[model samples]
Target: MRRAIILFVSLGLALGACDDTGATGTVDAVADVSADVSADVSADAVDTVASDAEVTGDTDAPSDTSAPADAAADSVAPVDTGPPPSCPEEAVTVYLYEDGNGASNSWYDQPLGSDDLPLSGEAVSITRPDGGVTAARDCGPGRYGFLDLPAGAYLLDVAVDGETTSHNLGRRLPRAVADGAVKLVAFGDSVPAYGPAPWFPEQLETLLAPFVTVTLSNVAIPGSQSSEWLPGGSNYVNRLAPHLADADVVVFSLGGNDLMNLASDFEVLGVEDALALLDDLDAAIVAIEANLLTIYGAVRAAAPDADVVWLVYPNYAMSDRWAQYLGDYQELAATLLASKLEGIRERMGDVAGLTLADMYGSLDKPALDAFLWDELHLNVAGHRYYAEEVFMTLGGVLVGPPTSRGVHRSIGFRP
Candidate 1:
């Protein structure tokens, strides 16, 4: 029995060493042992050997018996480090003002008492210079703001009671004065002067505030024509003189009233007399050109350092209602007026610091309907569109290369 036990133990040791060939090798060895040692040896010895084989974990054991434990030990996860990112800071605020009378009258010619009314619960959309929409908030009676904005330009569009107004905001001026501000003087007729709603100057003041402080002196006369701003005229020498010396930019839009005044008499005359009326109109245009040259001379004399921007009058007959009133004569008059204005624009460009803002093609009939409260005067929407055009023109001047001489260059009506 002792000899059998020793032999069984030796056989088990040998089988364990051969286990590397897989469970099949060990099972075959166990079967051989049972067949070879069964009859001669005691059952106790065979049982003991089988028990030892089971303990070796090589008999009928699963192929992946220790895989789960091994995988768990090797699968330790990594730890994370560092803080989360933060949001940007707010840097701009815009005020919302309401116009009392929602009529299609010249907002520019209206009294100040009718404007600057606080508006609440209006949607104000703030667009970044990158063309990303930063915020769209429901603002209270006075103001709306954009936080965490990097120092750059922005566009604000406010919608109140189905009326929308847009304004550009930024610190994009090329030159800054001693006080870090620029002085802008506007001298023209009603377009820049009167406002039941905010005019171009008022809108521009807010737009420029984010970029540089602006001292705007608007000396536009509502009922005045381009001829009224000539060298000897009080509107140019007196009313506009005091502000000219300190002016950084001088902007004006005239000649519309002059054409309208001429058109009034022609409209009263029959279409059969159109040719005779057109001759008179041509002579009137010549007079306007001469008057504008004198006005430009007076402005240059007043402020030699100031950059002059001439706003070309828009085609009022482009308005559907206005076109319907004048019929075929509207296109003829508009084309003739536009041609003359283009001449003025080219003439102004010859001056050293002078540029023209051609607004003749700025508004089509649809835009005219949206902006014009009357045949010639702009409503709130019209004023907003005008302000946008002027602001972009000024921006082109303020930031464009000095060699460009403050010329906006482009001729389209952009928003």
Candidate 2:
């Protein structure tokens, strides 16, 4: 009986334990597993949320300085003018510089101010680059004789002494302007003052319209050279002094006659004496260059502001004789030529605003053919070509007017 009571109590204890476990919660195997999974997923969800916030914050943290890097790069570009203007039709001040005294008065007229040059006479016409002419009338003396024209760009051709010169007419140059009223003084031998068909200065005036107060004055002489620009030796000084003084820009074309004259002198003296003569000639060149410097100095003194440029002779290689002469020069001529250009370059090196135009290199066969009205003097066509070359190639090289005044005078230039 004791064993039976023990066994029954044990059974009742087991049954009660089972009943209590079932009553405490209606436990399901799937329910328990789902509850455990949900708890784990909730923890994972918190971790993922924190991770996403960190990623988002990291991406946005450094975006503030990006714009500044871009801003700094754009600050250095230069300003650009979209399109250059054509000639303007208004009353313009035109300055004419002519070579020679008495009967040789070949008028080289260049227009001034922001207006178109006149074309009312047989004196002026329009020509294309390939060499064609449109007949026009002589607009009389001193009037830019054209009206009711658009403002863009045009090439003006003018005739002088039977040759034609092509001038680039535009309201303004593409380059930046140096000052308000830039004065341009054009000087040279017979060429600048005389073009074969179209007069160069008039065409030039037409070309440089609407851009500046172009005051071009020709100080070219018929028989001047690098050696002739001595203080008072050539009329160059007297004629150029005042112009230089008032000029904001000055252009000089010379050295051809010097070489031509010297070639004859060289033939007479022979090479041995030529060397000694060259030494003397070099001294003369120094004097001439010095005089030019003095003239520039005087110009600065007068204007207290001007830009100066020297256009060396155009390529004479166009001449068969010259080409042969250059060949015989061998190393010595090259040396001397290099030295001459270099010396002038060096001496003029310190001018406040100075530039040298390499007129020698730009000459081509067709161009040369057009320039030769005679063997040496430029025809109207030649002058026009020169003016075009100069306006296009040289206008950018000059620094535009001096800032300070010079105290010296060109009057004291002497050997």
Best by TM-score: 1
- Estimate TM-scores for all models: 0.52, 0.44
RMSD to the true structure for each prediction, in A, is: 40.7, 38.6
- For candidate 1, report its TM-score: 0.52
Compare the candidates by lDDT and give the number of the best one.
1
- Residue by residue across 334-384, what tens digits does model 1's lDDT show? 434444444454444344344444454344344444444444555444454
The deviation in Å at residue 104 for candidate 2 is 39
Q: Model 2, residue 401: what's the lDDT?
A: 23
Q: What is the C-alpha local distance difference test score of each model?
A: 0.47, 0.37
**After superposition, candidate 1 runs with Cα above 4 Å error:** 1-173, 177-179, 264-273, 328-333, 349-352, 396-415
